[model samples]
Target: MNKKILFVDDEENVLSSFKRNLRREFSITTAPGGHEGLEIIKNQGPFAVVVSDMQMPKMKGSEFLAEVKKISPDSSRILLTGYANIENAIDAVNHGSIFRFLTKPCSNEALISALHEAIRQNQLLTGEKELLEKTLKNSINVLTEILGMVNPAAFGRANRVKRYVNQIARLLKLNNIWKLDMAAMLSQIGFVTLPNHILEKVYHQEELSAKERNMLAEHPEIGAQLIKQIPRLEDVSQIIRNQNTDFSEHQKISTPLAPVQKFIVLSSQILKVVLGFDEMIFRGISKPSAMSILKRDKSKYNPKVVDLLEHVQISEKERMQKTLALAQLKSNMLTNQNIISLQGKMLVAKDTELTDPLIQRLKSYDVSVGVQQPIKIFV
Candidate 1:
């Protein structure tokens, strides 16, 4: 229940009057001009509502509120003007996305009602955004967990690539990273469609049949289609779909991409480089050698993204390898070696993180029969 409100006007007396009248009922801040108002918004903003005068000097209320929409989009805007006309009203709505348009000499009761309504509107918008983020995050977690269960090799690569993507995204100072993170986690979801033998051969750098090569090439699109079915994941899907696209194609994209387009392209570029680096590491190449190989092909990777790899510091704690008994295993521990049963069956693959369900299932299997002891793991 944010009761914060900002009022913008050219006249000092009008601002003073608003604070004097509404001070007891609402948390109020006032600015005497649009420039000062914008400063306030940049420094101490995200107010529940913003109200402005249309006839203000230098900057009109419609213009000020329009800027407010860009800086603090969640704030509900109201155009309170004395010289209200149909054109002014239309301009305010079109530019500011105004929540309410009320002329001056408005009754105190009407003003209070409009402010309250505006606050409610802001609340609804904020709540909806929060809900969507939560739903999408939960969905991502479930999908990744399922991938880990279905294909540990793919899941392990995805987890490693996610770490690399986070490093590059942070180095670049990206504001929102959930989409990139999502793209990294689900990038190999299409691998589930391929057989384990094919994945093994690819990992070992063995020659693949033309059919196998085509199937591997189609995995990105397969993963993208699977993800596109989920609402609000279209950008992530697009990134995954373009993960294998050459950087030369990205360069050919005309200058000044739209924000959405830029996000997808940049994220896809990061994924492409990280995926390649991971593959080289998997094939037993040293970090410097793998990076050098990637850098030699300038058109294959984004220079900026590839350069960030030099700065990325892999945490020793995450890579600490140890061997423990099945009884000592805990949830969230990464397996460094495959868990084999006494009967020579592979119980779990290397690089799979243990979950509660997985732990319980293993315990049941051990009790029912027997599993190899001293399981190799990373704490």
Candidate 2:
């Protein structure tokens, strides 16, 4: 599409002559005054270039261009003035944010060349902004997709954890909710460093050798050190660093990292209970059985995190039993409920049987019904 240019001047002959000269090269629009130009700007936005005469009845070119700077920043601005008004034109160019200043009676060659360059600059800025945004979005998505592979069972748990963290943030009444989102996405980055054997053993509640457990525990430091180099990912990395810290005085006892690092601390504390609940369910552990284990002897979990996790597990069981019972599932099916995942798609079922080889094959891509969708609220 041809680039659009808006020209503003109060003089009838000047507007008519400029439009006649530039009409064929650009999709041109002319306005008689500053107010009319602003109205045109509101009606047809995002023009590539805007050129205004320096002297006008109500507004000077600098003031008009300054206003344009706010209203349509992407549109390149230019000033046109008599040679005697060179000082004013210079101020407009510097402070008024005009792209170029031209003396009145500009030759056709000079005017056309300036307009082309100004439009090219506008296109470059817009393109750069779009590319940066796309890259950021893609990086964040990679964080989530990787999580799905590491633990298919925790997909629902992580979502629920984020919601609770959001609530806690609201409870804390902190400004800058964006930090919360960044922390939530990045807190699990360290899990990538965990050995798959330890990850599976942890999920299945298998007793890990001391060495294996220690290796698993080191993911936070490994992930943090690995991600610290990323400029935008630093906030996420900080959260990963503190994910294993206890809630009580973890923030105070440890020398605080950065303000952005606090999000990491908060997010780390949030994920523990949710991850616990998810790992138990995915391993086919029963609610009463899980609750009994939590109550047995001395548990390693923080008291608050444990209480919250147990509450969530009990509440989920009560809700699911009621919902599934209403559906009238057969007893045998309910006893051996199975989930099938093909690629990234989820299929929840009751007692669907498959060979051990098939399960292993699907697990290779980290496929499972429980991975893509995460549970959030209790209900």
What TM-score does candidate 2 get on C-alpha atoms?
A: 0.46
* Residue range 294-329, candidate 1, lDDT tens digits: 999999899878888998765434577888999899
Q: What is the lDDT of candidate 1?
A: 0.86
**Worst-scoring 10-residue span by lDDT in model 1:** 311-320
* lDDT scores in order: 0.86, 0.63
Candidate with top TM-score is 1
Pairs clashing within candidate 2: 156-374, 156-375, 239-264
The alpha-carbon deviation from the true structure for residue 101 of candidate 2, after best TM-score superposition, in angstroms, is 0.5
Residue pairs whose backbone atoms clash in candidate 1: none
Q: Candidate 1 at residue 366, lDDT?
A: 88
